[model samples]
Target: MHWESRHERAPAVTVLAVGAYTVDFYIFGDRLPSVGETVAATGTASAHGGKAANVAVAAARLGGRARFIGAVGGDQEGAEALATLTRDGVDVSACPRTDPPTARSFICLDSRGQQYIMTWAGAADGLTADVAAAGAALLRPGAVLVLQGEIPVAVSAAAAAAAVPGVTVVLNPSPVEPFTQPRSDPDAARLLARADLVVLNAAECRRLIGERAGSTPSGLSAEAAQLRRQIRTATVVVTVGAQGALVIREGSEMHVPAPEVKVVDTTGAGDGFVGALAAGIAAGMPLAEAVLLACRAAAVSVTRQFCIPSYPRASELSHAPLSPRQC
Candidate 1:
């Protein structure tokens, strides 16, 4: 999204994100060591993560007014997560603290930008549909309500159903587990039907819809088209990472290439892309242009060593030239 200075009183593009918040401990450098082997690491640091929190931080960094709604524990990690979100200019007033310990993710990054993550749900597992409904009410009309798979399915569905008329509900079904069953829960299907856009990886698209995805050269595109046919209201965006991104809407398709950059960490690349895309859409940019902007932002994100830490500010993205190489 093209961001005017906040001081100029431009209407803020509010984003209400529903998901989890976790303490992320990152060990970056080469491949993870074997069971009995210990390898040297280039660096180590910690940050606030979780699909929702990372996306909210990404949006805020890209000049959107982002708010995060979810459950956290009353422990030190929870306090730190809240502080991190507030520091990033994300509204977290509606984020509650539960009795369980806060969630945590330990990430190990390889030199090629690939990452392996292990997460603990903690209090996030307890988030309910009621909490999502309450959170949805706080979203401003025309705002964007973004959801991911980290929270309870019922909660995500409720948030999607409660979106304001002019608001866009964006769903990202990542890590691709819960919806793998042959038959989806009626409530989940209803929620998917309400999404303005559904963003996922190539594998996720396959899980949602069967192998009947078309015969296109790009399996991702074929699957995206199949998914769009199933849920008529939602546009499908399947990210193929280094292969760029594919967008399918109303039977039309577009491919946006990913910018080239040296790999470092890809932990939050998808979140970065989706967050920027949502910000662009909320700012009234056309879908194609928004996807392009999201690609650029994601390319920038992977060049750095961490997830949220790698996201650039809006001004940085606005002033930067696009990279030449296509991923």
Candidate 2:
């Protein structure tokens, strides 16, 4: 669906990111350690991560007013996560601190900047539908609700259901299995129905399409078409890293190609795309234009290292003229 003008104007477009937060430990080496073996690394570092947290920070960096809703622990990691998001100008007032320790991820990046990650849910698992709905309550008509699969599926569904009509719900089911798996729960079925837009990588699109269509799609274009039909109401965006993204909406498709950039780290690149996409929508950019900018943002992200730190600012994107658009 297109962005129709609301009857009355709102102060500013807000982006509410609902999901997980974690402290990411990055171990950099020439190559990943072998099974049951230890390898020396060239370097290492730690930063704030988690799909939702990375998205929020990316949006904030891209000049969008962002709000974060998720659970953190009463630990040092939690404190650091809050501080990091706050420093980036994201609103975290609605996020609650729980008894469980904060979630954490250990990432190993090779010289090529490809990442392998392991996570501990900690307090993130404590995110309930009630907490997510509470955060959704803060959204007004012109707001955007960003959801991810890192937290409970119920919580994400709750946030989507609670959003107002004029508010856009963007779902990025990263670690995509939870929602794509066969759902016995009815609410799980409605998750895609409630989303205004759904972002998926190649593999995610394949699984979702395979499950919904009862057969594997023949190819990328076919998968996009089938997925569009399945999620009839919401726009479907299939992101093909490096090559660009395919946007399928209302029987029409747009291929938004990303500019070529030197790759550094692909970690959180999808989050960067979703964040910028939400930011663009919140800023009143047309959906097609938003996807274009989002693709550019993601391309820029991979040229850097780490997660949130790798996201490019809006100004950075503006400085370099983007490559041509392929429809």
Q: Largest lDDT belongs to which candidate?
A: 2
Q: After superposition, how far is residue 222 of candidate 2 from its true place, in Å?
A: 1.1
Model 2, 20-121: lDDT tens digits are 998889999988877898999898898778999988988888777788888999998889889989998888887889999999899999988777898888
Candidate 1 residues 199-303, lDDT tens each?
A: 987767877776633445456676788788887655888888876799888758899998877877788889998888877776656788778888888889888
Candidate number with greatest TM-score: 2
Clashing pairs in 2: none
User: What is the model-wide C-alpha lDDT for candidate 1?
Assistant: 0.78
- Per model, how many backbone clashes are there? 0, 0
Local distance difference test values of all predictions, in order: 0.78, 0.81
Evaluated at residue 307, the lDDT of candidate 2 is 87
Error of 2 at 76 (Å): 1.3
Quick one: how many clashes does candidate 2 have? 0
